[model samples]
Target: MTTPPPNQNDIQNGAGSSPPRQQTVALVDDDRNILTAVSIGLQAEGFATRVYADGETALKALLENPPDLAIFDIKMPRMDGLQLLQSLRAQSALPVIILTSKDEEPDEALGLALGADDYITKPFSQRLLVARIRAILRRSELVRNPPEDAPGDEQAGTIGRGRLRLDPARHQVTWNDRSVSLTVTEFLILEALAMRPGVVKSRNQLMDAAYNDDVFVDDRTIDSHIKRLRRKFRSVDPEFAAIETLYGAGYSFADG
Candidate 1:
């Protein structure tokens, strides 16, 4: 398959550009054939690649330092993909894509919820996958260091919950003057959910915003994290349980 021309903006941005050095990709899958094929395909596209058979090994690698992008399989022998995603989100918002051989709804929904930037069903074409990788990479580069003069300077770094305050820069969350300690992922997820208040975001969308697609994650992973977030909020203010779960849909931060 013919490769699309390199993105000009991505090259100019230089946020994570490796070009001649070859971009690196972490591929985690239990299937040796799939892993080898993906690694070979990515290598053909000038990406340096690392392959892992399970989540535990992948997580260990990430702990030292994560790759620019990770393509993770949902079902693995150990430390399932969803758990790995949660672990990653608990600390860092790495760009991640969920790949699954099964096309089940639960898998899709859960992966999105866990903070996967994107999900690709199995039997996918190499070309489409490559394009998605490029697009995600370009977006990540842009987000890492947005242009100083970019429009909407006033809108940058503002986090709120109907009048509730969440100062990201200060790492503070308050409602009527009481502070809260939320995990970094929880904070970001809250920020995204609260931004539109009442507007429902699918599991996939929520995952994308919090993790920003920088890490490979699973959707069900999102459900587990949200459960943790709800528990924390319930501990502080019982009435502050406004994170509504829309069955068959996703979730919406209730309007205050």
Candidate 2:
């Protein structure tokens, strides 16, 4: 006789073979059509999704049951994307990607300044969205589980330049012995700079180092990240001046 398929519990317990648990993504948007379409696309790609119609609701649910990643729409009612981003940043460093409409460059810049990891304008391709999500998640995973045989696989796994200390394995940064919190993107950007002190890296070079090639990031995005990076370091040490800009060129990390 033919055997029946394994039940959910049996599959989960490995009594029968099954794919690993799918990562969950929280999709926040007031547009029902967009929400449904994106949710379907994400689910098709082996991702479980939680959908919300407004920012306030999404924020509550997200904090209560955090997901692997989140996507927010800039024009949501009750609580817009920027406000939700602000609330989320206050408590967690959950990787976030914001959605904006065409001609909303200012909004995009503001979102990035407020700690958004990335932003995509409206009318974006679904495939493009998926690619962006995967890129961010990939970075997050790397930060969580660094390579066992990383170039510097020491007990501390830390890199230092002057007063700045970076621990790639721990995904931590310290300045003058004090801890400083940085978003995954910010950490990557700073790491690239600190890796080669006094070496000016062009915007394209920094972008290549920080993000996957599939995701298209403009020069302003890099500039915004640099600005936030400096702001964060300055907050910890008022006289922080390690990052320097070269007009008509790019940026370099001072060895001081």
Candidate 3:
């Protein structure tokens, strides 16, 4: 596989001109094929990428110089992604996305509990990965610099129900005044439910609210996100019961 030649404007800009710096994504995986393929795919889509062949090496560079986002693969030879994530979470809140083996919930739950923003099952589509990257990045942007006029945004503005409060403009959530850190996907799903408290939202509806129409996400993905949302809130409020399930009828939020 050959790399495409550099863009003419990129060469000119690097030579003597100034341009906006590309958003860099760091990818850590032991598989050289995955590292090479994903890095190329991301670059072709207009991103700067850094790839590492193992978790131990990636962890060091990540601490010294973080990227806008990171994608980690579990089960690395040297340091394993989970340990690296635990260490990084202790020092930084840099947004991270994870890759997990197919149908694996324990690792997914553990990663999300440790503050990962999103996860994609293995054998996933590059299109889906790119879509997830774009979604999380957009949400990150909203958190950093919110616009008052982006009200049309599904995750925009503030929505409150009982002890739960969501300030999408700031990417902030609180349960009974205690702050809760949530992934963009989690926040969006929660936002949808809280927007119409007492009303049930099917997984499909929630997905539509959180993801672009072009991207296809299975129902299990939404279910996992819901599980993480509950787990995060419960960490702060042991009696957190605002989010409810109806079994075969989707989920809802209790305003009272």
The digit string of per-residue lDDT tens for model 3 on 186-225 reads 7888999999999999989988886656545667767877
Candidate 3 colliding pairs: none
Give the worst 10-residue stretch by lDDT in candidate 1. 5-14
Candidate that beats the other on TM-score, 1 or 3, i.e. the better one: 3
TM-score of 1: 0.58
- The model with the greatest lDDT is 2
Q: Top TM-score: which candidate number? A: 2
Q: What is the TM-score of each candidate against the true structure?
A: 0.58, 0.78, 0.68
Query: What would the TM-score be for candidate 2 when compared with the true structure?
Result: 0.78
lDDT string, candidate 2, 10-75, tens digits: 111222432464577888887777776777677667777777888887887788888888999999
Each model's lDDT comes to 0.69, 0.80, 0.77
If ranked by lDDT, best first, what sequence of candidates would result?
2, 3, 1
- List runs of model 1 lying over 4 Å from the truth: 1-22, 142-256
